[model samples]
Structures are given as C-alpha cells and as structure tokens.
Target: MRGRPAALLLAALLTTPAGAATLPSASILSGTCCPGTLWTPDSRSLLFLDGPPARASTGIYSVPAGGGAVTRRFSSVAFYSPDLRWAVRPGTGDATTLERLADGRRFTLPTRGADVVWSSSEARVAYARSDTTGNFDRRTTRVFVANVFGAPRQVATVYGGGPTAWLSEQTLLMSGKASASARDRTLFALNVQTGARTTLRSALGFRSVASSPDGKRVVYTVAFDSAARNGLWLQSTAGGAPRELNAFGSYRWRDARKLLLIPLQTDGGPHVLRQYDVGTGAWTTPGDLGDQVRQGDWNVSPDGTRLSYLSARDGNVRVLRLP
Candidate 1:
C-alpha cells in the first residue's frame, strides 16, 4: 500500500494515539532464554545460539514463533547467510570457508577470519579487512567482492567505514573518509563492476544505516554533528537532499515503503511501536509492547507481518502479530 509521496514536513511522528492499547504478545521462550536470535527466512521460527547451560550443547537452536518446543536447528555453528542457504565459517587463519547447505560443497577465501556482507540474491558477497594498528578513523580497510566459488577481487579501500549494503549485484554502498586526516565521512555508492562512483552523503558518522528491500532508499542517523546535520535522516541512494525525521530511536524497515520504530522514551512507560508510511505522510501506532525490550533486541520478521523481541520484563523472547 503505497500512497502518495509523504508531506515530509511533520515535526515528529506521534507514537501514541488516543486510546492506544497494548499490543498482544506471547513469550515463545523462557528461562532468560537465548540471545542473538534471528528469524528464519520463512519467518515461522526464531534461531538462536545457545550452549550447555541453556541447551544440550553449543549449537544453533530454533523455536516456533507461536510458542512451542525448542528444536535444534544446526548442530554446528557457522555464520549462516540471511537466506539460510550458505554457511560461512572463518577458519583460525586467513581462510574463510563457504559451504552450500544443499550439497555440502565448500570453497575458501582468505578473509582473515572476517565474515562477509552478502548481496540480496546471496550469490555474491563482500568482505573487508582493516589494519589492526592505527587510529580507528584512519585505519585502512580493503574491501573485496566475490561470486560463489570464485576468486575475490579487491573492490574499494575505505578509512573508518566499510560496505553498508549492496544496492544491486554490481552497486555497493560504502562510507569512509577520503583521507586519513579528513574530519568527515563520505557515504557513497560504488559500481563494483565498472569502478564508477557516486557520492551519497558526507557526515561525521552514520548510525543505524539501513536500506529498503529494493535498495533504492536509505535511512541513517548523524549525531553530535553540526545542528543542521544532526538527526535521523532519510535519503535516496541516487543522491539528493535528505529529510530529517524528527523522531529518534531504533528503527527497522517494514517492507519497501514502511518503517517500524520503537521510540526511545524513558518515562517508565511501555515502548510504543509506531510505523511511518513513507508514501502516506502519516504515522500509525500499532500499539505498545506492554514491556521494555531487553538490550534493545528486537526485529521485524522477513514477511513484515510479525515482530519478535527479547522481553525485558520476563527475560524471554516474545512474538506479536502486526495489525
């Protein structure tokens, strides 16, 4: 439901509407259950890493979203891709292994124990390795991209920041300073294929950088910078003026055109889930969680119809259907 372009002038997206009620939620796991839980691509279950204290041994475990028996998902630990098709394990040395789950076929890359940034299709990936000794903002980071079972080619060199997201199979969004002494960082797009580049935005630093599912738009935060440049801003990947969102807190893209935000309110009230529809110029309160999120651990399901979070009140994982 894309509507007309939003007004883009509202000061703050109100999180609480009149007569707002608590959204219904159910705890799916208990006993100070797992951390690092992630939704399965099908969005029906949550996968988390647990050890002997919480489970039989240290491996990946799964629990249904609607609350049920926990099952062991993966017997071994590896950095599974977002699509759950590939498992990447960085070896003890300079090699990282990529294994296709379907066939158990594997290949290796010299990534120095660093994981990869996968493209949407999960067919290609990028990784970066930075200099261990130097000022953090000035350390050199060499970025590389590779196709599955192919050699990695050095693509972009950055100082401070690395690949934020892949805009397309060939276009990568990157951020870093042009030189070591530069005070600001440049958020730009790189055509990994033709070596072409486009400057997106330059700021002191970007926080919570996220791209829409289609990779056409981005939202990020710039804090402690000059007044004009500080706020949660939304901009296009194609390069244009950014619009500041008057609200602040953790945010997630709820599909291509909608965004879910949990406002950082500290008045001892339940955390409210407010959604901003980019195409409609309106904010809708989906209701509150009735409790705080533990360690700010929360996520929207892949299908955008449900949400899951570690409940601060009970120290368990909870799930709720979106209205």
Candidate 2:
C-alpha cells in the first residue's frame, strides 16, 4: 500500500514536476473572435474588432480576462481615446470627428484621416499632414496640436516625420530630416508652448520610437543603416548620448524602469520572455510562452501584472499572469 502511494506521487511528479521553469498556464479567452486584440485601459478585458460573419454586428467586442461571453462594448467603431472618453471618427477626406462619450459633445479636426497622438493626460493631441506629391522620404509634413474640443493650429514642419509622442502636457517628441537634402533624421524634443527644441539624436532612420510612461526617456530602433548605429537604442528625451540595448527583438516598456522583450527567434520554438532593468542594467529571463506568438502580437499590461498574446498554435488570444 505504501509503495502504491509512492508510485502515485511519482506519476504526478512526472506529469507536472515541481520547480519547473515552464510558462504560466495561459487561458484561451476568445471564440472565433479574431486577432488584433487590445487590452482595455483598465486591463480588465480584451477588446477586438469583429463583424457580421462572426458576431451579431460590426463593433468593438470585449472578452473578460477569465473568459466568458463576448459582448459588444460599442455599437459603432472608431479610433477611441485611451480612456474611452472620446470616439474619433475619420471621414473619407480631411475631416475627422471627435465625439465626447460622456456628454455626446462633438467637434472636428482636419486630421486628414490620420489618428491623433494623445498626451499622457489625454487632454491635448498632436497630428500631422504630409504632402502627397513629393519624394517619400522628403515630403513636407506639418505637425499640429490642439486641446480637447478646441481648435488645432500648426506647430512645426519637418521634411518627413510627424509627432512621435507627447512628452508632457506641452512638449512633443518628433523626428525628421533638418531639410529635404539632409541625409540624417533629427529626433528632437519640442516645447510647443515655448518653441524650444532640444536635439536628442541624429540617425539615418528611427523605428518603433516609444516614450517612457513618465515621459522622461525614449527608446527606438535603428536598423539597416550603418554598423555604428544599427541597434536598439535608449536615450533621454532631455538630450543625451544614446545607449544601445544589448538584446533586440520586440520590446515594450513594462513600467518606468523595466522593459520586456521577446527575442526574435525563428527556430519554431516557444517564444521566451526576457526583461531588462534600466536602473541596474541587468537582464533576467522570466519564462517562456510555451507557444509561438503570432504576428508579434504581445503586450505587457499597463499595470505590469499580466501579458496577452495571440497563440500561433490555436489562433486564439491567450492571457498569462506575469511573474
């Protein structure tokens, strides 16, 4: 009888061994829902766009983190503000409508069908309009900013790039060539109120530029340019030498001080999660996904407690609690 109990315990251990470094169990949280899932700002639910063939009507639908009924959150879809306070509906032309969700108050900005880059407070927004008939890299781009329900005015003009982020209530991060003939792009911080510019870096090109949550630092990718500058770089928006992050892949800021990444590995193995600390300059491997992430679709939650990714093996959204 004692041997039988021991054998049962051994069998259990063989199936699920203790202290294993496997990924946290991920719950598939959707039906025939689809991909392109985004977390609600509260991080309580995942939202996806769906249409008549799969859902009752075309709208934004939400699924509970724990998996339950998928319900429509909005009857009509638009570029929603981060806090869900406004719906930005772009017309077929230059007119884009902004409807305040609370009071149904409405306004319009000539955003030319381009979505607005909102400030951290969601009170101010920035956007750009580019000339259509110029060289792709040297097109004249005009940047504009406005307050909620207010008028927009041109703030700056660059050869190609547009507003990257609102570094603060009054500051904007932007990049483009100094002139149409220049070979380098200048990534700089602009004070919209004071018209002061702080040059951050000049590079052949910048990709995936993201600002830290606190608006103090920025990280970006410089690829296919030159050997001396082709890497993932981090720099202060206040202007400083860029530091190249040793590891590269898809990266997102986990918080003010840590960045989460899944290294670009194509061996058909499960994607692994790694983290880097800006304060200590150390990297740590937390765990693996145990499944491939489809289309690089993964994001660390705003609260940094969880992560969500689309499963390559199942074509379903999966959620995992992060360590």
Candidate 3:
C-alpha cells in the first residue's frame, strides 16, 4: 500500500492500451498545481483551481487537453465559474464583487459574503448571505440570485453548513440540514423560477456530491463508519433508491459509459486513476507513468478522449497526461 511496489503497479497500468489511450502525458504548470475541483466542458480545455487550503489565497487556472502553459485567469480568492469564463472574487471590506474574464470587468454586487454559483447558462450568479451575532446562537442565512452585473434577488433562507449544485437552468440541488443534531443532511431540488422545492435524499450522511455530464444522475460519497471508511453511490435525478458502487474513491463520469475513479488503499494512501465501466460495473487498474510521477488526478478532457491530473514525483506537483 506504500512506496515503490505501489508505484510499480501504477506504471504497469499506464503501459496498457486502455490506460495510455485514456490519459496522455502532458506538461505541468509553473507552480504547484493541486486541483481543487475539475471541470471539462469540451475536449480541448480543462479548468481547475491551484492553491493552498480552502478559503485561502487561490485562483482558477485552465490548461489545454495536450498540456502546455497554465493560464492564470484571475487572482485572489475566487470560486468556480459555470461557463469557466467568470469567477466570483469576493472583495475585502464592505462590498463583494464579481470578476469577468471576457473583458476583465469587475462589478460590485449586493452581497455580504460570496458563496457564489453560476447559472446553467452562465448568465447569472447566486450566493448566500449570513448574519451571525456574538452570541453564536443567533444566526440567519439566506440565499440570493443576481445577474452577473445586476441587482440581487432573494431566493430562500436556509440553515448553515450545506453544499449547493445546479441541476438545470431553472432548478438547484442543495444539501440541507434535516435535524438539530447536524448528523442528518437532506438533498433538496429547488426550482428557481417557481420557488418550489422537493426532497431528493434524506439522512444519507453524504459528504461530496457531483452531477453527471448529462445532469440526469448524481455521484456522491458517504461515510459508512466512525473510523472514516467511506463508499461511493450513484442515484438518479428522478428520485429513487441510491445504488452503491463498491470502489472506494472520488469519481467523475468521463462520459455516459465510463467513470474516472481514484482508488484509496487500505493504509489510507491513494493508489491510482482507475476507470470504472458504468455498464458492466468493473474497474480497470490504472497504469503508471514511470518513476517521475505517481497517480493522476481523475479529470477527463472536455472532449472525453483523454484524462489529465496532477502528479507528484521527486517532491513536486507536475501535470501528467495519459493517452
């Protein structure tokens, strides 16, 4: 589970046809490229964040499918963009701002803090505002939506500590606290236009949620034990029982047929990038990229032909391509 032997297995997988064709060798960015989140809109470009710690100094960067220069789109703290063109960078002090990459335009929006999310069309941004008094017991959090440069519109008031995902142009998928103990979290689908909401999942204890490429399915991880053992599950958007997928790792749908999963060893170390066949429910062991790199980030190219991920070798974070 540790050291050279594990690395060798990874290398063997890389030499195989399926591993090599899915991920191609590529160049690394100038600095450490730790992918915070990955987004693939097409086959040509991949967008992700490279930085240290959440809520710290970080920015968004994009690299080509073949891998070359990592373009720094914006500076300071920012969140992911829907269309990958604009990022919401909350300013210091009294006002919050949205930064547009098209023309480098920065506009002030009415928001106390930025938990910004882009509309499905990437034409608007939504965020949450919270008021916490010194008492710590009295607090209020509300969600709002606004055009990229227009005024803010109130959506709904939600409790603290939950994640949100856009299901479609008119609906939002949110994980809300369902109990006072905070042990249970419920998934809710809210319609932005009608203000109607419905529950998707309840008491699931899931930590991460990712929507499929077609927006018809969702993949998420939930802890199964107190020792931090976890499992991955897939649920349909139509709201039925979740089907558990046995592989242990964070995964993303490469297309409608395949999933890019990063396996976790029993010793709590990451193994390699594994491709899971959604149709057959089988895992293809990942190949290695020789001694200079170990493990690729589970990110597929926008076109679905190649997989690119951050590789750490010789004490550096290098961008490695597998194809």
Candidate 4:
C-alpha cells in the first residue's frame, strides 16, 4: 500500500504541465525598503522613494536588477517622464513645475496638485482639473494639454473618469459618462488637435485600464457590470469590438502584443504566471512563482523577458526569469 501511494504521487508530479514549472526567482532588495519600486526606462535598475532613518534624506533611489548597492538617483521625486528627460512636480497650489533634467530650465502649469501624463517624446503633457463637490462619478472634469513651455489649452471634459493613458503624441484614451446620472461609463479616445472622439466600450465602471507599450491596443477590466460584460477585455485603439479575455486577476503588458497575468487565486498557494498572445489569440502558462505577489506590486520588464514583484512571503522585491 505504501509503495502504491508513492507511485501515484510520482505520477501526479509528472503529469503537471511543463510550461507551468516554478520559475527561478531571487530577492533583489530586502530589509523592507521597497513597496513602490518602479523600473528604469532602460529596465536596468529599479527606482524607489526613500527617506530618513533609512538614509540621509528623502529622494529617489536606484538598485540594479542583478542586485547591488543602493544609490540615490534624484534629489527629489516627481512624475518623471519615461525617457527621463523631464520631471513634473505638483505644488500645494495651482502651479505645477515642469523641469528639464538636462538643464535647470523650468515652466509651470496650473494643474491644482494633479500629475500630468507625458507623451512618448516628453515634449507635451495632458492633465485634468475637476469640480470639488458632487458624487464621485458625476464631478465635472476639464482636460488640458500644453507644450513644455507653452500656455495650457483645454481639450476635453469628462464626467466620472478622466484621462487614463496617452496612446500617442496626438491621441489619448479616457473614460467617463456623458451625463451625471447615467449608470454606464465609456472608454474613449480623443485627438488633441482635431478634437475627434471614438467610443470603445461601455460599462458600469472600469478598472485596471492599461494601454499596451506601443499604445496600439488597450486591456481593461469591467466588473459588477453584468454577467456578459464583466471580465477583462482588449480592444484596438483605432476602434473595434472589445475582445474579452477568459482569465482574470492582475496583468501587465509584456510587450505591445503579449500580456502576462497572475490569476487572483489566493489559496495560500504559489502564484502562476500565464500569458496571452494577442496576435495569435492563444493562452499559455509560462511559469509560476513559488510564492504570492505582495499587494500586486509586480511588473514586467520593458524588454518582456523578466518580471519583478514584491514578495508576500518575505516582504522583498524579487526578480524572475520568464519561460
């Protein structure tokens, strides 16, 4: 009987999917120094905000992906451009400062403590100012865009949600309702120059609305909307029917076409890494972390070859090589 039980266990292990093998992962930063770490533009290092007791002063710090000594990269932290060319710093008042990292030259925008979303070139930005009082989903929001050192120009207005992501230098993706009392919200695109608008999807509300790296496609979640409308969906920026993704949980774009997901299976077990290829319309289990990700604090690398997450097991940032 004992021999039979051992043989059955071995068979079960052998029957497991090879692609879902446990990925190799290691802690890159420990001692509880990270919870909001972001990857560098080049994906070579991770950036985080830290201050006194842990260091000399408050600033942004960096650590190599392969693990190394921590170093300060910026004296102050703000919404930095992806190209690392400019820093958008919001003040206590209406004026937000925009500074070029290469030179000390700066300009100010009346953003009222809201951060501006930068274009890929880091030349132009879009931000919103909303009415202070009303229902959370009914507040009037006015959207504006401006060049690095130019006057602000109002472009669009939204009721509930506002500008979510910039699809291109001239285009942006956003969500809101047409009327204050409408239950359905819309995810749409706006042309900054021509003032053209294209509606993509409608639901009770949307969450985790993420644009692809190339800004060609978007993936978002619509939950508690309806049985048919609830789940993850993907759509083209040029406008098309929304394609529902079968799986759910936390996801990040591995590249322009590939999306990596960690299912919301909190069974005190390992977290599996599954991938969906938009071009091929296929789903494959890449691998699984031997532990759970802490607070969804995980992201795919810029090159789409690796992933990093704050470990729920040890409270540290860990790097994993994808299969």
Candidate 5:
C-alpha cells in the first residue's frame, strides 16, 4: 500500500512538472501565403507581400492577428514607413520615390536601390550608397540623410557594413572597418547634425544588431570572434560599458525594457520563450511553444503583449499569447 501511494505521487509529479515550459498557440494563417511577414505597428494584423498564382496581383496584403478574412492593404509594394505614413519605392537606378499615404504627396531621393531608414517621427531619413566594385568588406559606403522633400546630403563614410539602425532622429548606429585592410570592425554611433561619432564596441565581426524602441539601448551578437567575444550583448546608446547577456539565440524587444529570445536549440523539441528584463537585470523562461519557428520567422508585437511566428511543422503562421 505504501508503494502504491509513492507511485501515485510520482504519476502526479510527472503529469505536472514544476514550471513546465509548454505554451499553447493558435494558427493565424495556413498554406504559406508569404515567407517574410511583418506585423503592423498597432499589432492587430500581419503584413506580407504576395502575388498571382495564389493572390490576384503583386502587392501588399494584411490579415488580422486574431485570424480572419485576408484583405489587401496596399495595391503596390514598397518599403513602408513603420507608421504606414509613407511608401518608399526604389527604382531601377539612383532615384527612389517616397509617397505620403495621406495626401499622395510625393518626393524622390537618390538612394539607388537601398531603402532609407526613417526616423522615429518619419520626418527625416538616412541611407547608404556603397561602391559597386571591390571586395565587399573593403568597399567604401557613403551614408546620407535628407529631410522630407529636401535634397540629400552626404554625412559619413564607413567601409563594410554600413548604417544598421537609426538610434534617434539625429543619430545613426553603424558598423564597419576603419580601413579596407583593418582586421576588426567597430560599432559606432554618428550624430547626423553635429558630425560626432562614439565608438561603442569593437570586434572581429558583428551580426544581428538591433535598437530599442526608445533608441536608448542596442543589442547585438558577435560570433566566431573567440570564446570570450562570442555571445549577445546589451549596451546603452548614451555610452557606457556593455553588459553581456548570459544566453544566445533569436531576440526581439518586447518593449523598451524587456527582450524576448528563443534559444538556438535544434533538438527538435519545443521552442522556448525566454524574457530578459533590462531594468531589473533578470532572466526568466516564461514559456515555450510546442513547435519550431521556421527560419527565425517570429516577431513581438509593438505593445509587447503578443508574439507571432511561422510554424516549422506545418509551414503556417501561428500566434501565441505570451505568458
């Protein structure tokens, strides 16, 4: 009888493990309507580019995050401003067109085929024009900024990777080499108005750079640089010593202070959602999806309440209510 009671206790413990990491999710779309999908600024719907064979014509489409009938948002595709206020369409040559969605007012920029990164208010923009010929890491790239309807002005030059993200209205966070033959790349911030630069971090190479929503902090990954240099790091844009996160994987800012990450564990098990609180300097594994995210196709909503991802099992989009 005592052995039977012990077995029953073991069964209960197995059924309800402590802090089990499984999270339930629902599908938002099926049949692979699009590959790279983006969430709307409001986080109510997802936007994707699609065309005939499945859709009627080549354009931008949107579907609600709650799952509903699909609808067309824009007739033609363009690199849209985050606020959906402007559509930037690059042409075959040096000129790119910017159209205001409200009044249909238009202007052109000499951005070549590169997309312009818009400022927080969508009032100013920055872009890079790189030398077409030469080894990619050695080629010189000129960064430019222009006000809406204003002429483009050359600001700075960096070799290799150019402007990665706009930290603020007048500052740009970039990574590149000092010279073509330089062994290491430097991640620096540039003030477009004052022409000032602040060196943040230096390494052999950097990947997956991202800025916080408020533009006060940045996170990035440095891999294959050496055992000590590899992993994810968080630093302030205002200049401070960097704080390295203990974990590594795909990450996105859930808000100005919280970051969500899915560890790069390819064990064919459920994908886990780990949250890092920048303010408290704490880490917690809130939950895990019972599926794999396809090709890192996952994003946190603008409000940081929900998450959406492409399911690897069925090749469809799924939405999860973050725990």
Candidate 6:
C-alpha cells in the first residue's frame, strides 16, 4: 500500500492520518501557483511570485495560517516585516520600494541595484551590490549596512559573492565560488565590528545553506551529482564536520532536537515526511498523511509545531496543513 505512486493515492490519504488528526484541506488562490521562495518570520504567511505573461507584472499574495482567501497583491515581490506590519520591497530593478501595510504608505530606498535583507530587529536593512550583467562576467560584490530609512554604510568588500546571513547584530555569513570553474563554493562568517572573516564550510558541491533560528547551527544540502540525490547535513556555527542524516531530499530544522525531512525514492518522488530525533537516531513518519502531492513545497513552522505544504490537487495548488 505504501509503494503506490503519489498521483494515484494522494487524494485518498488526505483525510486519513495514521496517528494524528486529519490534515486541513487546501484552497486555491489563483489558477496557477508557483513554489514559494519566502516564508514569514512567524512562519504564518507565504510570499511567492506568480507568473503567466512573464514581466514585472508578477504579483505577490499572502494566505492566512489557518487558511483563507489570499489577499494583498502587489506589482512587486513582498518581504514581510518582523512584526508583520509592513513589507519591504527590495525592488527587482534600479528602484527599491517599501510598502506599509497599515496605511499603505510606500517609500523608495535610496540605494540602487542591490540585494537586501532586514536586521533581526527589523529596524535596519543590509544590502549588497552587484554588476547588472547577463554574461559570464567577473565583478566584485560588496556588502553594505543601513538603517531602515537612513543612508547606506559600506561594511565589507566581498570580492566574488554577496550577502548570505547575519550571524549576530554585527556579523554576517556570505559565500561565493572559489574559482572560475563554478564547481566549488565556500561559506564564510564575517564580523563587521572586528573585520574578521571565518570560513564555515567548503564542501565541493554544496547548496541551500540555511542558518538555524537560534543561530547556533546550520543545515545544508550537498549534491553528489546533477541528479539531485543529495545528503542533508547539519553543522555547528562554531565550525566542525557536518553530520549527515539518514534520509535525503529537502530538510528543515524544526528545532534544535528534531528535523523534518522528505525522503525521495529513486524515481525522484517524495514518499513521506519523516521527523528525525537527533538524540536517539530515530526516524519516525509523523503520520500517514496519504500520498505525496506533486509540485508542492513543504515548510515547517519556526516553532516546529505545524507543517505547511502546497500541492497540486485536481489541477490546482492547494495548501495543506500537517500534524
């Protein structure tokens, strides 16, 4: 029964949970939905760029945590505030736009052509600038820091890469290719206060590096080949060899003690979402929530209590809630 394909058995399992309460039914916001790229700090709202005509006309939509109409569409992509009061519009082009949700006041950021990230407190913004080219060009990517409404400050001149993550109030994590071959990527933790750069990881073919919420651990996926059968690894922020977990595919740290993993079979299909107990080295399926939904991205909340995944069922993208 467990060996059945996803498309055949997914709907039947939607109402059945092996051990927990039945998962929530999903609602479709539009005729089409893309895999979301950003999840809010509280893990309650999801922001994704929907495309059909292909241009800046792509809009962003937000759905409730318990599920409802996905309101609030914007001409540009949206990044929610830490308090969910406003959304910082890191523009897709030369201009930067910030939108206030309460009164709908829009502000333009002074910096031109940069990648932006918000501070932990949401009172400051950090950014990096890169050459706007569509070629095999070599250019220096520099990091900068600024208040949410003030002038920009140059923090560091990172040669090849852009900003990655903020380690502390003054430290940041950045990465770039080690050589022109584009085969090797390295991770570094840069201290803004002391101008010290620390190498974190230098795996040969690593990608999707994520810092934990507590900022003490990092989880990333390393692919052995282009086929994408990668191993999920967790390492400490203090630096050490990463410990590889048993299951493979996409993974997220639900908390420090547990991890959520989607184990993919050889045919490139996810079979189940499994929770890994770090202390006992035990892997348990949360519940038999039925078949895996195709074309859906799964996310576990920051508190590690709920799992939200978007799947294509009956030709529409429906968001599902798991136990």
| Overall lDDT per candidate, in order of appearance | 0.87, 0.83, 0.60, 0.86, 0.86, 0.62
Residues 1-323, model 3: lDDT tens digits: 22347457455433334443223355544345454436456556666666555324567666665557667555654664656577665667647767777798878875666567766688766677666563222234567777767887887765543336677777777765633345456667778789988776665366668777666677777675332224567777668877777556556677767777765433323345667776786867555444223453446655566655555544333345443
- The sequence of per-residue lDDT tens digits that candidate 5 reaches over residues 262-321 is 887555767778889999999877877878899999998898878999999999988887
lDDT tens readout by residue for model 6, 129-242: 765563322455667876655767777664456676776677777776544455555777777778787777765545767776666777777666433234566777777776
lDDT of 3 at 255: 74
Candidate 6 positional error at 83, Å: 4.2
lDDT of 2 by residue, 1-323 (tens): 22356556334322322233667755656453668788888888888889888877899989887678889999888889878888999997899998989899998999889869989888899999999897968898999999988999898989878888888999999999878898999999999998899999888899999888888999999877876787788898898789887556788888889888787765676777888888888877788888878888887777888888888888778898888
- Evaluated at residue 64, the lDDT of candidate 3 is 61
Ranking by TM-score: 1, 4, 5, 2, 6, 3
Q: Which ten residues in a row have the lowest lDDT in candidate 2?
A: 11-20
Among these predicted structures, which one has the highest lDDT? 1
Off by over 4 Å in 6: 1-63, 68-79, 90-93, 99-113, 133-138, 177-183, 224-230, 266-270, 278-281, 315-322
Q: What is the TM-score of each candidate against the true structure?
A: 0.94, 0.91, 0.71, 0.93, 0.92, 0.71
For model 3, the superposed segments whose C-alpha errors exceed 4 Å read 1-24, 30-82, 103-107, 131-140, 179-183, 224-230, 266-270, 279-282, 286-298, 315-323
**Candidate 6 steric clashes:** 0
**Candidate 4 residue lDDT tens string, 1-323:** 22346556445323434657888997889988889788898888888888888889999999998889999999977878887788888887799999998987999999998868888888889999998898879998899999889999999888987898889999989898888888899999999999999899899999999999899999999888777787789999889898977566899999998999888764577888888999999988877898999989998878877799999999999998777
Q: How accurate is candidate 4 locally (lDDT)?
A: 0.86
Runs with alpha carbons beyond 4 Å of true place in candidate 4:
1-19
lDDT of 1 by residue, 47-132 (tens): 99988877878889999989898889999898999999999998888999999999999999999987698999999999988898
